[model samples]
Target: MSLDALTFRPATLADTDAVVALVESAYRGDSGRRGWTTESDLLDGRRTGADEIHAVLAKPQNMILLAELDDGSGPRLLACAHIAIEDGAGYFGMFSVDPGLQNGGIGKRVLAQAERVVREQWQTPTMRMTVINVREELIQYYVRRGYLRTGRFKPFPYGDARFGLPKRDDLSFEVLEKSL
Candidate 1:
C-alpha cells in the first residue's frame, strides 16, 4: 500500500504476456471476480489480446505503465494502465490491478503516476477514459479522482468478442475526463 515500494516504468515488448495476463486477471474470468473491478458478470472471454497490446507498444507516443513490487523476490507486476495521446489529450485505458490488491492504495498511486506521465512526459493538459456506463461504482471511483462524466457515450464493440462477450444488450461506454 506504500507508494515508496512501488516501481513505475514503461513496459517493453518483453512484458506483453505479463501485461495481458494482468489485464485479463483484473477484469475477466473467474479470477477477476476476486476484485471489485471485475467485469466478469457483465462480460466473459478475454479483456485484451497480445496482438492488441503489441500494436499499442509499436507506437512511440503510447506506453503501458507498469507498477511493480519486489515483495522479497524480484519485482512482480502489481498493476498496469495504458496511456496515449489521443486528440491532443491523454487517453487512459486498459487499467488493471491485481485482484488481490484491489481496495488498497496501489491503484490510486498508479493512476497518479499515469497522470504525471501524461502531463509531464506528453505535455497533455487533460486525460480521458471510457468506462462502461452501467459500472456506476467504478465511474464514481474516477469521479472521486477528479474525472467528470461528459455525458458522451461510445457503443461497446458488441460484435467484437476480442473486447469481451457481452452478457446483456445494454452495455455501453461513457466518457470521463480530468484536466491534468
Candidate 2:
C-alpha cells in the first residue's frame, strides 16, 4: 500500500495474528525477498506467533506500534515496532515493514511514530535497539533515523531460534541508541 493510504495506531490483542503475519512476510519468507529487510537467508521459520504478540501486550512496560492501511477495506497491518521500558529508556525492537511496501516512507513514518510514543507516552529520554552486526543496510537505516552506533556487541542466541536461524556463524548484535 502507498504511504498516503496508511495510518498508525497502538496495537491491541486483537491484532496479534495480523501483526505476526505482516512481520513474517516482511522478514522470514519468500515475500521478504522482495525487500531489503528480508531475514530469509538467516532464518527459515515463523517470525513470530500469537503467544509472543499476546505476551507483549501483557507486559505493562511494553507496547507494539502498528501501521494500518486506511482504504476502509479495514486496517491491514503494514509495519510494526516493539518497544519496552527499562532503566528509564525505551528499548526498541521487532520492527518490520511489509516487503512489497518497503523503500517507501511507511517504515520511516512508523519508526518516527514509535519514537514519539516512547517519549510522549512513556516519558523516556532515549530509545535503544540491538541489530545483528552484519546487517549493514539496516544499520545504516537506523543511523539515518538519528540512532548512533554504541559499539556494544552481544552474542546472537543460536541454539534458541526464538530470534531466527542464523545465516552466518559470525552473527551478533550491536547496540544503537538515540536520545528522544
Candidate 3:
C-alpha cells in the first residue's frame, strides 16, 4: 500500500477502545503469537489501558501517534507509535503494528513518520526507547531499524501488577537510541 494512504495524527480519548484492541492483538494472547511482535512469553494481561492512554494524551511532554490506513477493506488502524519527551530527548515507546502486516514495509513507513514528527516537532537531537533485555529478537529488530543499543538498563517494574507479573527473574530494559 502507498504511504499516502496512511494518516498519522495524535490519538484522542475517542480512539482508546480501538487502540486498546489493536495493542492487545499486536502484543498479547494467542492472536499476538501469530506475529513476531508478541510478548506473550514475557508477560500477560493488558498492555496500555484507556486511563494510561488518556494520561499520555493529557501530558504536555507526551503524545501517542496513531496510524490509520485506508485499505480497500476499510479504515484500519495499522499501527501506533507512542512518543514521549524526557530530559530533552524524545523517547519512543509502546509501538504496535497489526500482526498480519508485520513483514510488510508498513512498519518502517510508520516509524519514519514518527521519527519525523519527533525531530520536526520536538526538535530533539535523539530518539530513545527501551526494550526488555531478555527479548534479544525484538531488540535486534529495532537495531535493524536504525536504533543502536546504549548499554543503559533500567529495572522492570516487578510488583507493578499494571505491567503484569514477570515470567523471568532477571527482567530489565536496555536503552536504545536513534539520532534525529
Candidate 4:
C-alpha cells in the first residue's frame, strides 16, 4: 500500500483483537518471519494478547496509534504502535507493521506521526522505547531514525508469559531515546 493513502487514528477498545493480531504477526510466530521485524529466532509465543491491548486502551495517557488503508472494502489495519506519556516523556512501544508490508517505509511514517503527536499533543521533550538487547539490527534501525542507545538496560520478564517465552537464556531490554 502507498504511504500517501494511509490514515492515522487512535485505537479504541474495539480494536483490541485486530491490534493484537497485527502485533503478533509482526513480532512473533511463523507469520512474523515474512517481515524483517520478526523476533522468532530469539523468542517464542505471542507478542501481545487481547487483554494487553484492552488495558492500554483503558489508560487515559496511553494510545495505540493505528495506520489504516481504505481499500474500498473498508479501512484495513496496516500498522500500529503504543504510545504513553509518563514522567514527562513519551514512551513508545509495541510497534508493528503488516508483515507483508514491511520495508516499504510505512513504519518510518508511523513513527514520525507518533513523535509528532507526543511532541505537539503531549508536549513531551523526549520519546523513549525499549528493544530486546539481542535485536542488534532492530536497534540500528531505530538509531538511523535518530534514536540514541541509552545503555540503560532492564531484565526481560522471563517468568511472565505476557511478554513471551525466551528461546534462549540471554534476554534483556536496552532503552533507546530521542529528543522530540
- Cα error, candidate 3, residue 45 (Å): 1.6
lDDT of 2 by residue, 68-104 (tens): 8867766678789998897778898889888888888
TM-score of each: 0.97, 0.94, 0.94, 0.97
RMSD of every candidate to native, in Å, equals: 0.9, 1.4, 1.4, 0.9
Segments in model 2 whose C-alpha atoms lie over 4 Å from true places: 1-5
lDDT of 4 by residue, 119-176 (tens): 9998898999999999999999999999999979999999898888899999899999
Output the better candidate (1/2) by TM-score: 1
Clashes (N, CA, C under 3 Å) per candidate: 0, 0, 0, 0
Residue 107, candidate 3: alpha-carbon lDDT: 79
User: Quick one: RMSD of model 2?
Assistant: 1.4
Q: Candidate 2: deviation at residue 40, Å?
A: 1.1
Tell me the tens digit of each residue's lDDT in model 3 across 1-180: 676787888888988888888888998999999889898898987777888888889999688888888777777798997898997888888889999888887778778887888899878889999998988988998899889999899999998977766778899999999998
Off by over 4 Å in 3: 1-3, 72-74
Q: How many backbone clashes does candidate 2 have?
A: 0
Candidate 4 global lDDT: 0.93
